[model samples]
Target chain A: MADANAETDLKQTPLHDLHVELGARMVPFAGYSMPVQYKAGIMAEHLHTRSKAGLFDVSHMGQAFLIGPDHETTARALEALTPSSFVELGLGRQRYSVLLNEEGGIIDDLMVTRPVSEEDDGKLMLVVNAARKDIDYAHFRDRLPENVSLQVVEDRALIAVQGPEAVAAVAAHAPKAAELAFMSAASMEFDGIDCHIARAGYTGEDGVEMSVPAGAAEAVARALLADDRVQPIGLGARDSLRLEAGLCLYGHDIDETTSPVEGAITFCMQKRRREEGGFPGDERIQAELKNGPGRVRVGLRLDGKAPAREGAEIALPDGPVIGTVTSGGFAPTVGAPIAMGYLPVEYAGTGTALELIVRGRRLPATVADMPFVPNRYYRKPKS
Target chain B: MTTYYSKDHEWISVEGDIATIGITSYAQEQLGDVVYVELPEAGRNLSQGDEAAVVESVKAASEVYAPIDGEVVEANGVLADEPAKVNADPEGGAWFLKMKVGNSGQLSDLMDQAAYKAYVETL
Candidate 1:
């Protein structure tokens, strides 16, 4: 039974009432009542996002901006916090990066985007994990130079529409967003309401994530829902889709102790950032970059139908526990159980035989390649 | 023959000394799409309220408790290959196991069809 205080303490998004009206099974997520699954269930919601389009209420995510006098100062200020090269991030483009603590451990993973509008030149927008929002804001408030400021956007809602048919479903209302290249963002009128839409998502699908005004969120969502090709997805499918795409979930796949190198996300750091060593944890990151991390995150494909979850022991095929599963579940797209975990570098190679100790049974598994399902981002044809 | 329900959401239908056990339809609905099921091995002795089988959905795993003391005689191996059957026909073809009752009198401790319905409504 849900505790009374816990239920009362749970926050609701702008679309909470809409979720209930649609017969959504609301569950507490990151201190908010988020939909884990709708009536169609996780399986159907997951499959629909792969074939058609799935609308997700991601408003629980933390949205904020780092403000400065110009783009350089703003980007440089952010570059000090994360390993990624933000200065070179062009207008309309977005880059994924992680916030590192003084020890170089990941504090949180976030997406940084430079808005396309010229009026927004001096500000870099950020979207962080909901659970870490307070930590992130406090960290920024304490660290950012006096010349720069951190402004949290509390009145906006993030709506993500992902899948193969996502673009068509959303483009019917916001035509300019359809023109965006993957990793690009644009300010456009979505259903006649001003929204910041980006052609990027966690699901590894061709889709858009729109930052809409909180009050207009439902109207915009209802407009997109009118499309026959779209379905409202719950957080349950959101997790499975990202797992199949080989994406990491903060506090699970990574934490304050895990470095970006060990987390298998080195690409977020550009060559300049890697060589300059200006970011937090650069000393350890540079060392790991040269010598390789002692342990690395790898994908695991279990043999049987039984799904092994987070904290399951990962063992060598013939003996001994070596690591623990970080994120795992039944991948609806792959039609099999898939998982990701940290393993000793020696045993992290693809095709390496492994075993997952679940329910006291050592189930056979293999060190498989990631993105159990392929990423289908909509990239522009090169000129 | 009589069907009895446990508060843990498992149902056991007793016929003579043999009893068939499975999760209730309400339990299956709460579990969502079942991906896997692990049943007790034949000859495994279970006391009332002991975990007798495991039912796994895409979200997580749940233990189905033995409503009454029994010795597992046979498990429905078909569930291993097609676990979704539990969601499709939870009360019928998807019965978890067949057991020889250890104490038929313990069956009296379980809820009857109508009483079980009322108990579920309270939840």
Candidate 2:
């Protein structure tokens, strides 16, 4: 979330003081004073997490719970707003879904987790982008059934421990957490505070996300960082990690103007949801599902080393502008330049050669399969 | 040999007729990861302060300007596969290119080590 107001008057996270004490380079991001990098710098931080573990303070995200008497009523109300099949989601499991507008464009991408039991009054939890939280809450408040209560959890801080050794790093602090499978979350005790631990992350690695109380966040982060395998990574490394994982940043890759189909995220809509068609933007989304979108998001491999940044115009063989790059940079893992952009469906296939016009020079590029680096998401055995 | 720096943080080490150029360590740190380096082609003539190469990181892309009027004598091919070397050794092994000095007088327009240090402080 990018708050124009807070951009000038930056807010501070629970770890802000810690980051400053550690000599981190703080920059304004998503309405907070965030560390862009540390003394090791971005390159080392990028590779460090790929090889070891990195702890990220993502407290800027919004955490909230939806309570209803039963899961059916709560999930149905949420399904009315998002595109995912939340009702059928098993207990302790989570799904990546999008909140859509009436026209089918995304409001934001969020994670919805089912409650651990039917007795729990709060049956659903939502983690949303920080910048859009206020508006998102207002939308929910107006649309949701009175039976389902939306309670914003303001006293919590979110931290992500990501990489191959993340599980071990975090498990050291909360040993019981070692058994939690990917996308499954549970309320547990850590450092004498109740915390919600989810086996999920943005880096496409085996990791766990902890929603700790504000007071315990710093202690949890410090404990994790105390491990030789874990280091505190900043937003700079976080951006590169997600980019390489082929995940989209909220404002850059998917916004209100881009539909789910156009963003190449139609897989988010379950078959049941597709047939039950009561959701917003159903007509446009279902139509695109059948006929394909006019423009689709795809990855690009620049012919040369020159990076084609966001807003760079993409052209076809005849040099007509077809689309613009949404996100582009050098992929440290790939050893070359990589980009993600929307293009006409005809130009969205793997190996569809194209050109990027930057500064009057047309550099050759080609559509490539995404997750520029292969994803490593952990999934439990299917029973 | 004498070294000179541009405000944009590029540094050039000049000998008799050839000059070796690279980005300052501060520049690399600001850029984060140096993932790709687009070096100028050998024999490409460049004027002082002209954009001669491109340097990209995981988060940003920057243009490396020619330190002085010169013709590219050699480009760093090693960077194509090992661009991280720039982060590892910004001054010595990560030099972007070597060029034949075309107008040595342009060197006077750049800052020396002491001046460059003070310039960085102001930033």
Q: Who wins the DockQ comparison?
A: 1
DockQ of each candidate relative to the true complex: 0.75, 0.45
Model 1 ranges off by over 4 Å:
none
Model 2 per-residue lDDT at A183 = 88
Pick the lDDT winner: 1
RMSD of 1: 0.9
Model 1 chain B: weakest 10-residue lDDT segment is B61-70
lDDT of 1 by residue, A245-325 (tens): 999999999999999999999988999999999999899999999999999999999998888999999999779999999
User: Model 2: which residue pairs collide?
Assistant: A1-A131
Model 2: per-residue Cα lDDT over A1-383, one tens digit each: 23556555988888888998877988887778888998887767878888888989999999998888788889999999987898889888888999999999999999889866556744799999988898889989999998998999988899999998998888776876788988898888776678889999998788988999898888898888889999989888898788888888888999998888899887788999988788989999989888999999899999887778889999986579899999887676776778899998987889998999877789999999989888777766788
lDDT of 1 at A11: 94
Clashing residue pairs in candidate 1 (N, C-alpha, C atoms within 3 angstroms): none
Candidate 2 lDDT (Cα, whole model)?
0.87
The list of candidate 2 runs beyond 4 A from truth reads A1-8, A303-306, A317-319, A358-364, A381-383, B13-20, B41-49, B66-82, B97-109
